[model samples]
Target: MKTKFFSLLVACLIVTSVFSQANLNDYKYVIVPTKYDFLKESNQYQLNALTQFLFNKYGFETLMEGDEYPEDLVRNRCLALRSNVTKDAGLFKTKLLITLKGCNDQVVFTSQLGESREKEYNKAYTEAIRNAFKSFEAVNYKYEPKAKDVMVATENTEVKNEVAKEIKKLKEEIQALKEEKKAEVIEVEETVVEVVKKAPVVKVQTKEVKNTKEKVDMKASTSVLYAQEIENGFQLVDSSPKVIYKIKKTSMKDVFLVISKNGTLSKKGSDWILEYYENDVLKQEVLNIKF
Candidate 1:
């Protein structure tokens, strides 16, 4: 009886150790979101599917995923996470965080999920994450992301001046509208002109037409404001490589920022060369931003 109990205790210890030392990698390239994001958010199934497909191709299994209980509220997910974590919380956790492991505890990849803002992040977010991860082609497992150089600015005084003037105009228009709203008196006029009856009616008709046109213009102005505030529609470039390179800072003379497929910003320093591959094969390194 004693021997049997001792053996069982040893077995239990081994199992516990295995669970505790679980590798947190998902794959080589994509640092992925944990499964909880998929379970909690009913929508974004397409995002979930793409994530699974990428990791499954590389033999990644979903480890035990649950509420992460971050050290602080993890800034980004304070609302969902319920804490004061970070001001740029969206930078990290509003997105799902998936992990993949390989070869006895080596980290493969971790990917983030969700778009940055309230806007419904489209399939592009996932695609961006996937492509960012896919850029890593080393089979032996080196996951250093690189950044491209910031383009040199050319001298164009005229263009710069025009842009400055246009921006100023837009700002002034926005302010003028706001001021007009605060101080203007909206008067509804009614007057009976005793002179030449037809002439007075014509004047009244002309004023009514002008008011109608003004109403249409006001409605259009409100729509323009809504578009500017809500849909910003800023375009971004891929910067995972740039971000990684900056972090490494190996012989880097300048800095670059990159967006991983997971929609997070990364930094890269100088010594980075561009790499291209089609299915785990390197095509070439061009060494120039445009190339």
Candidate 2:
């Protein structure tokens, strides 16, 4: 019975040890700092780099403080464990231990103390750090993000709800502003229409007269002419705003003449022709006119 009880106790202890190691494996990543508080310089003695390399070798993704981190780790730094290396000095030997802590600064795992008898600072520190990693080699590390506590989860949900409420309020305010702008545009358009309705109308009369001396009948029509009032007389345009002719008043009442850079137009047997001086020579072009 004593032998059986001893065996049972040993088995239970083995199971507990295995459970603790498996729990530690749940962490997805480890963050190593470029410099430790006790170190004089960043990556001094290459200890930080060595620590990162060992963490990576042990199947835990590792990043230095200056290295770009994964999005999940960036969002929730609690997702990864922080690695710390400590040195223990003796008269004849150097001792080292590596520790992993959570965001709460609580130590999660610590390696057994490793000692080296080398006299040089670089070699002794390197040997001691390598010896310390032996404890890490025994456990299998696979990334499994730790679950948040109930309280933390509830707090996060509340924060998300508040953010959602704020976004909704902003959207509503934008919609209200858009509606107000639309109403203002409609009001301005209505005011312009009212002003146009109240504007004064100008009347132009057309007369058909016979010129027996010239053996021609001249008819004046406004349908083919689009005139814009200018300072002198008017500018004649077609369907578009491009000025086809510039009409200026003459000494004769109600009579106008065409002025253009290309030429001046005169009536010849009911057809108009443009005459201009070009290259010290007179040039003439027949003009097609409705009036």
Candidate 3:
């Protein structure tokens, strides 16, 4: 009877473990911090990089903190788990443990304690982190977004399609207007030519040149902007600490609607580009933004 009960308990435990691992598949991304709490600076000894690599190797899509997130993840942060590493006090050895938390700050999973006896900080941390990742290897994480996430994605897709259709319709109307205006201008020019041909021609010559320079407005573009997080977005300030532009968050990732400038700020490659209309002319400026 005792043997049978023990076997049943073991089976229940195995089932529970499997269930927990399967739940992890609901998360689409693992966000690793650039710096661990135990370390002095960011990515010290390349430990964070190794952590990211290991997560990727175990079939988990990993991203470093502060990296531009996918639009879905930005809209619904709960789809991604935040990773943290903690170091335990050890006299003769280095020990590390990895913890993953949800967007609500709930602990989702914790790795087994990883230990190394190496004296060097780099080697010790690397070995300890790798050892701790054995748990992840066993689980073999693969992203399988939940039903709710899939529904949300579908809704977003529908909205984007509607918006695209409206934009296309507007473009077609503008093109038709331009064609009509071009035809009207040609007719007017032809009338002017007929009048000139019917009238006598007279030419006037002058040696003196008249000044035709027009006043132009110059904007300073050398000031570096500092981003300060606000309620829905951020306010950019210059070195003098004066607010330059207030940008609001958009549904798209790495794209913000500039409230102050009536423009859009978007990330293109490694640069942040600001585009707005000034004096009926569209202008694009590369912003030196420190976030």
Candidate 4:
């Protein structure tokens, strides 16, 4: 009697897994939020970006929260699932889990708990997220939208065209804002130069900036570093998955303040260079960075 009961439990587990996989495969895309409720800032420690990256890596089509949605997804929200990462209280560990919900706000799937004991916030979050994603290894997800969604797509050609037009308009607006920001940066630089000329103390600071720029290496580094978005600006990481530098945005375009280091990170042509003072001499190292 005990053996028979064990067999029945195994059968039930298999059936539940199959059902969950079927529901997951019916959705074509997943949307990851720009920020998680447990975090104070958008993409803090690059957790949100890491979430999207892991989903795409695990055979799911993932989109950022504010990204333009496909026409069918816009028309029938049920065609996509919403993704969320939740934190669990732990005394000495960072614990997290991934949840996927349907259009009706019903939870469709939840990943196993992922925990990390790393003391650093960034490392802890990264490890916990990757651990949570391990649950998807067996899913083998491939979108097989239901027949009803396919039929709606076939019948909504006009609506698709309108969505396309709206997407185009959004792109134009984004470009305009970028250009406006560049203009403001240039104006700020001009004002700074005027102040330097009028004040003796300011003039000395201007010379320091000039010397830093002059020390920059024109040749770019052959090795590349990846830039991960953080709260203010970005953190550059090496291939070893180590943080090389954390930079904050400056008013000037393509220039960043290297935190804790008396230096600046700036773009020269297509290459990024780090200029810092070691002892009394200024040193420059060109960096190949991917954002």
* Highest-scoring model, TM-score: 3
By TM-score, highest first, what's the ranking?
A: 3, 4, 2, 1
lDDT of 3 by residue, 179-273 (tens): 99999977866764465344221111011111323232324367789999998789999989999999876655887778877767789898898
Q: State the lDDT of candidate 4 residue by residue for 135-167, as single tens digits.
A: 898788889977877777766876779999999
Off by over 4 Å in 2: 1-16, 146-291
The lDDT of model 4 is: 0.85
Tens-digit per-residue lDDT, 35-60, candidate 2: 97777999998989998998888888
Worst 10-residue stretch by lDDT in candidate 1?
A: 218-227
Model 3 misplaced regions, further than 4 Å: 1-13, 198-291
The TM-score values for the models, in the order shown, are 0.21, 0.50, 0.64, 0.53
All candidates: CA RMSD (Å): 36.9, 13.8, 23.0, 28.5
Ranking by lDDT: 4, 3, 2, 1
Candidate 4 stretches greater than 4 Å from native: 1-6, 157-291
Q: Residues 4-110, candidate 1: write the lDDT tens digits.
A: 99999999966644442232221222223443332446225455556556554544332212434332123222112110001113653233344444434444334
The TM-score that candidate 2 achieves is 0.50
Best by lDDT: 4
Backbone clashes in model 2, listed as residue pairs:
none
For model 3 the TM-score comes to: 0.64
Instruction: Tally clashes: model 2.
Output: 0
